[model samples]
Target: MLQSRRRLRSRIFVSFALFGLALTSLFAAATIYMRARLEDQLINNTLQREVENFVQFKQAHPEPDAPWKLSTFDAQIYSARKFANVPFAWQRYGTGVYDIRDFDENGKLRPYKLAVYKDDRYWAFLRLDVSTQRLSERQLITALGFAVLIFAGLSMLIGRWLSSRVMSPVSDLARRLRSLRRTGQFEPLAPNFADDEVGELAAALDDYAQRLTELVQRDREFNADVSHELRTPLAVIATTTELLLNAPDLSDKMRDRLKRMERASRQSTELIEALLLLSRAERSGPIDGETTDIARVCADVIDANRPHLGGRPVEVSLRVESPLAVNAPSSVVAVALNNLIGNAIKYTPQGEVVVRVQDGRVLVEDTGPGIKAEDAEKLFQRGVRGEGAVGKGAGLGLAIVRRLCELYGWGVGLRPREGGGAVATLDFQPRR
Candidate 1:
C-alpha cells in the first residue's frame, strides 16, 4: 500500500523562506561592511586635512616667540609636552591616523580619532572626538538587526501564502479524483484551474477519465452480452438434464451421471447470474438489498456440492448460531459461501469440512493440507491458486468471493489452521 508522506505546500513554503532569509542576511552583511569602510575613509581624510591645515598655519605665522594657541572646527591641537595631558593610548600613536578610546576630563570613556605629526623641532598631535559617530553606528547596527528579523518573518508569511496559492489547484484536482472513485462521475477540470502546470495536470486527468469511462462502459456491455449469450445454452442443458433424470427406466449409473450433469449446469447458471450481478453492481453501485439467511445459504451450498464429493470420505457439516441474517442478495451470499465451502471440500480428501456462523461471521474450516504462510493472502487474488490445491480449477473461486465481499462492504480473510488446512472467515459487518 502506498502512503502519503508529505505535502507539497510545506516543502515549497520552507524553500522560499530559506531563500529569502539567505538573501536578506547577505544584503545586511554587505551594507554593514560598506558602512564601516566609508566611515574609516571619512575619518582618515578629515584627520589628514586637519594636519595639513596646522602645517600651513605654522608656516604663515612664522612667530618664533608667539603663544602656541591654535583652534580648528573639529579637532584640538596640542604640542608634545601639552599632549601628555591626553590619554596614553593617543600619545603612543605614531605619525598616522588612529582611532582610540580615552577618558575625558569628566572621567567618562569616549571615542576619539588621533592624528600625530613629528618633525625635527616639535611633535604635534590632533585629536577629534568621534563619540557621536560611534553612537550612531551602534544605533544603525541595532536597527539593521531588527529590520532583518522583521523581514525574515514577513518572508515566511509571504512564502506560506504563495505556496497555498500555487498548490490550491492541485489540491482541488486531488479532491476531484477522490470524488470520482466514490461516484464514478467525471467532470471537466480544466475550467477550474489556471493556465499552468496545474491546468496541464487537470487536462491529463480529464483525458484519462474519458478513456476510463469508455473502457468501463465497453466492459459492462461485453459482460452483459456474454451473460445473455451463455445463459441460453445453459438453460437448454439444465432443461435437458432435468428431463433425462425424470426418465423412469434409467439405470443406476446413467441416473447418477445425469444427476451430476444437472448439478453442474445449475452451478454454472448460478455463477453466471452472480457474476452478472457483480458486474452491474460495479457500474451502478450495489443494487441487491434483499436480506438472506446465512444458515439456509450454507445448507443449500453443501447440498449443491455433494455430487462433487463422489467417493471421497470428506464429511461436510453446517453449524448455525441464532439464525444469522445479512443484508445482501441470496445469490451473492450463496456465491461467496459456496466458493469457501467448495474449496474446503475439494481440498480435504478424507477429513471433515465445517461451516460455522457465529458473531456475525461465517467461518469455513477444513482438515486439508495446510496453506503456506506466504500464500495465505495471495490465494485470494485472481488467477492465484493455493499450493495445497488438489483439483483442477481456474483459481477464481476465492477471487469471486473476495469481490462479492468488497461489493457488499463485507470483510473476508483466510488464515492457516493450527494443526492443518485453512480457515476462511467472512465477517458481515461492513468494512469502514
Candidate 2:
C-alpha cells in the first residue's frame, strides 16, 4: 500500500508541476497580445482627440477659405487651400494641411497619426506623432515584465500548495510508520485535512502499518531459531577448554601445546569481542546531540596507544584549536582516533606520528610508505591489505573506523602527506 501511494504521489506531483508551467506560458503570451492591442487603441484615440481640439479652436477664431499660393501647393489646389502644406507622418495628406504616413500591405496609403490644423488659419495646430514600433514595443515589454513577475510568483505559490496538498499526508504517514518501527505501538491514523491524493495516502499508510506488524512478528521468531542453534557449539567449546586447563599432570611439550591452544582460544575470544564492537559501531545510528571535545578524544587515544609504542620514538603533536566540539558520542570518536593512531604505529617502523586537529579535522600522519593508488580503494574493506602490510590480524580496524564515521555522518579520508608517508584524516562537523 505504501508503494502504491508513492507511485500515486509521483504522478500527482508531475501533473501539478506541468499544469503550473502551462499556465505560466499561456499568461505570458496573452499579456503580450493585450499590450499590443492597448497601444494601438491609445494611438488611435489620441489622433481623434487632437484633431477635434484643432477643429474647435479654428471655429472660435474665423479663417475664411481663400486663394493662397504656397511653395508646397499645386496651382489648382492653391486657390482652394487656406493653410500651409505640412508633412507629418501617419496623417492624411492634402493642400495646406499636416498629414501622417503609414505602411500598407497592398500599396495603399495607411494613416498612422493625425496632424490637425484649419485652412488658411493658425488655430491651436499641433502634430501628433505615433511610432507603433516605439510605443507598442514599450507597452509589450512592460506587460511582459509584469506577466513574468506575476507568473513566477504564482508558480511558486501554486507549486508549494500542490506539493503540500498532495504529499503532506504521505510524509506524515511515513513518519508514523517510522515511529511504529521504532516502537511497537500501532497508533490510529492522524487526521488528513486534505481531500485529494494526500487523503488517499493516509488511508494507504494505515494498511501498510498492519502488514509491517505481521512481518516483524515473523522476524522475531526467526532470530530466536538462529540464536538457539548457535548456542550449543559455543557452550561445548567453553566447557572443553575448562576441562583441558584443569588437567594437572602434563609433559612440557603437552603443556606447551596446551598453552598454544589457550592462546588460540584467547585470540578467538578477542576476535569475537572486536567483531561485536564493530557490529555495534556499524548499527549505531546518527550521532548523539551532546557536544564532545574531539581534541580530548584524540589525546586519550594517543595516550592509550603510548604503551604499545614499544619504546619506538614517536612524536605527538596536538594542534587543535582550544575546545574543539561536535555533536557526537565521545566513545565513537575515541574508537576512530584509536584506529588511526594504531595504524600509524603499526605501519611506521620507527618514526614520529603527528596527530593534529586543523580546520575541524583530526589528521594522523606516519612516515611509513604511503598506500598505493590501486590499494587505496581496498584499504577500508575488512581483511583487505595494501602492498606492505604484514601480520594476520584481520584488516577490520580501518573498516570499523569507516563504519563508525558513516554511522555518525562524519568524513574520513587517506592521502599521502607531503615529504613522505601517508596521512589519515577524519573530518567531523563542529558544534556551533
Candidate 3:
C-alpha cells in the first residue's frame, strides 16, 4: 500500500513536470521565433532606408572620385571595384539581397544587412550594422529560457506540495489503523478535515470500528457465559465420580469406569478454565499478580498424571536446577506444562519421561517413537495430530498450549530427542 502511494505521488509529480515543460517550451519557442522575425524585419527596414538615403546623397553630391567613408545612418559604402578593404565573403556575393555576419574593425562579430544598387557609371553597395538589434534578440531568447527553467522548477515544487496535501489524510488514517492494532481501541479521526473523499473515508472507518467493537464484545460475553455454564456440569460429574470410586465393595469394573469418568471430567474442567483464561486474555490481558513456582507446578502435573500410568512401566521424574519462578497465572502455566507432560506420557509406551526446569525453560523429554519431521509444526495447530499419536484426543492439547503461550508472551517448541522420542520446551522468560 505504501509503495502504491509513493508511485501515485511520483506519477502526479511527473505529470505536472511534463505539463510545465511542454507549456514553457512552447511559449519559449514562440517568443524566440517572434523576436527573430521582428529583428529581421526591423533590420531589413533600417537597411532599406539607409540604402535609399545613401543613393540620394551620392546623386546629390556626385563625387565619383571621393574616398568611401562611414555614412550618417551607421552604415558604410563601398564601390564594386574597391575590393582591397572589403571582406572576402562580401566580395564573393553577386548583386542580390544578402544578410551576412562578419567582424567589425574592433574585432567584434556583427550582423550586416546588405543592399546593392547598379547604375550606368558605377555600382554602389550599402551595409547596415544591425549588431544591437541582434544582441537584443539574443537577450530576449536568454531571458525566455531562464523563465522556462524557473517555471519548471516552480511546477515541480507545486506538484510535491499538492501531493503531500492530497495524501496527508490517507497517511493519518494508516497511522491510526496501526495504533488501533497496538491499543485495541479506535481513535476518532479529526473533524477539521475537508468535507471531501478523505472525510468520507474517515467516517466509513469509524462506522466499521463501531460495528467491529460491538461484535467482539458480544463474542467475549458469549464465551464467558458458555465457560461459566460448563463448569456446573463438570463439577457435578467430578463429584459424582469421586463418590462412586469411594463406595465400599464397589465392583472393580465400576471403579475403573468411575476413575475414567473422573479423569475425563478433570480434563473437561481444565479445558474450560483454559478457554476462559484465553478469552479474558483477549479482552483485557494476562491476569496480574499471578505467579507460580516452576518446580512445584511440574511436580504436581506429574503426580496428577501418575494414575493413568497404570502398568505402563514408564518412569516420570522432575528435576529443578533452582527455584525457577514465573510471573503468570498458575492455570496458564499448568495447562501449558500439563499438555507437554501429558503428551510425553501418553505417547511413550514403556520409557521414561523427564521434566526439567533450567535456564528459564521447562523441558519435557520422553522416549517414544519420535515424531515425523512434517508433524513437528503441525502438532501445534488445532485438530492436527502427529503420525505416532497414541491416545484418542481432539488435538486441542498442543493448540491450547500454543494459545496460552501467545497470550502471555511465552515461547513453546517441540523437537525430536536425539536417541529417540520427542522433547518439548517452554520458555517462560518472556512472560516474566
Candidate 4:
C-alpha cells in the first residue's frame, strides 16, 4: 500500500548505474589480463632467441673469457660434458623458457623468465629481471581503477538526469489526475501526452473516470429521489398513527401497535436521511456544524434494538461512562449505532449486550461465540457475514455502518473480545 517504498524512476536509475559499473569493471579487468599476457609473450620470445644466440657464439669462440654483451639480460654458461659444472637445479632443465623465483648467487630472491639452450657440449642460460615490469603493472591497475571511478560517477549523474526527464510526463499526469478528482470533473488526458504507453494509459483512465462520474451522479440523484419519495409516505403514516392514538376508545393493545408503527416510521425516515447523506459523500454543511449528542443517540439505538432478543433472557443495556458528542448529523449517528447495537442484541442469545458510550466513542460488546480476530474486518464487506450465520439477513448492516463512519470522518472496527465474545467499536473522533 505504501507505493513510495520503491518507485519506477528509482529502478530505472539503478539499472543505468549498474550497467555502467559492470561495463567499466569488465573493461578494466580485460585490460589488466591482456597487458600481462602480451608482456609475458614479449619477454619469453626475446629471451629464448638471445640464449640460443649465446650458445652458437660459445660454440664458435670456445673461450672461457669472452666478451658477451647483451641488452638488459643476464647470461650463464654450463658444460653438460662435465656433470659437476652445472648446478643441480639447472641440470634438470631442457631447452625451453621457464619461470623461476629463486635465490641468486648473492642469496637474494628474484623472479625471472629463464631461457635454457643445451646440446652435447654447452648449456646456456639467459634471464631477465621483471621487477620494473611488475611496477608498471601496478601503476596500470591504479590508473584503470581511477578511470572506472570517474566513468561510474559520470554514469550515475547521467542516470539521474535521464530519470527526471523520463518521469516528468508521468508526474504531470498524476498531478492533473489529483486535480480532476478534487474538482469532480475529468477531461481527455491522451491529448496532452505523446502516442506511447503513457498516452494509452491516459486514454484508459479518461474512459474510466467519465464512467465513474456518471455513475456517481446517477447514484446521488437516485438516493435523493428515494428519500424524497419515501419521506412523504413515512410522514403520513406517523401522522395517521398519532391521530388514531388520540381516538376516544383506543385499547392498550391497539395503542401499543400504533406506537410501534410510529417508531418504525421514525426509524425509516432517519435511515433514509443517513443513506442519502452517505451517497452524496460530502459534509452537506449541515452535519459539519451540528453537534449531535451521540450518547443520547446510542441510548435510543439500544432501546430500538432491545426487542431483537425476542424471548431470550438476554440483558441489553447502555452505559454512559461519559458524555459524547460529534459534529455530524443525528441520523448518521443513529444509523451507525443502530446497526452495532442491533447486531449485538441479535447475536447474544442469553448472556448480555452492552453498549458503552465514552468520551468520543461507542463500544458494543456481546457475550456470544467469538470469531477469529482476522475475520472481524471481513464482516464489514458487503454481502459478507459471520460463519454459520442463520436467519434472514442480507449481511449489509455492518457494511452500511462502515460506509457511514467513513462519510462522517469516523472510525469503526470489530475484534474478538475476551471470555468468548465479539466487540464492535465506533469512534467518533477525527483521525490524527
Best by TM-score: 1
Per-residue CA lDDT of model 3 for 6-29, tens digit only, reads: 344465677677767876776767
Compose the digit string of candidate 4's lDDT tens values, residues 1-432.
112234455656676777678767767676767677657766786687678878877888889998776544789897767857776777788999988776755788877788999999889988876655666677677866776687678777777776776676688889889998798667788788766556678889989878987897898788878877999899999999999999989999998888778778878988888777767766543443768888788877776766567799898878889988777778777888888887877777789888898878889899987789889889999999887477999999999998987776789999999998899999888568
Model 4: lDDT to the true structure: 0.79
- Mind sharing the TM-score for model 1? 0.69
lDDT of every model, 2 decimals: 0.77, 0.64, 0.76, 0.79
Error of 1 at 59 (Å): 29
Error of 4 at 408 (Å): 4.7
Task: Give TM-scores for every candidate, taking all chains together and pairing residue i with residue i.
Answer: 0.69, 0.40, 0.67, 0.65
Could you arrange the candidates by TM-score from highest to lowest?
1, 3, 4, 2
Identify the runs in model 4 with alpha carbons over 4 angstroms from their true place.
1-68, 75-78, 82-93, 100-111, 160-172, 178-185, 235-258, 282-290, 298-327, 340-393, 406-432
Q: Rank the candidates by lDDT, best first.
A: 4, 1, 3, 2
Report the lDDT tens digits of candidate 1 across residue range 255-350. Answer: 888877876787778788788877777522325665688898888889888877888998888888757988766767878888888888888888
> Candidate 2, which ten residues in sequence have the lowest lDDT sum?
71-80
Evaluation by lDDT, superior candidate among 2 and 3: 3
The TM-score of predicted model 2 comes to: 0.40
Cα lDDT of candidate 2 equals: 0.64
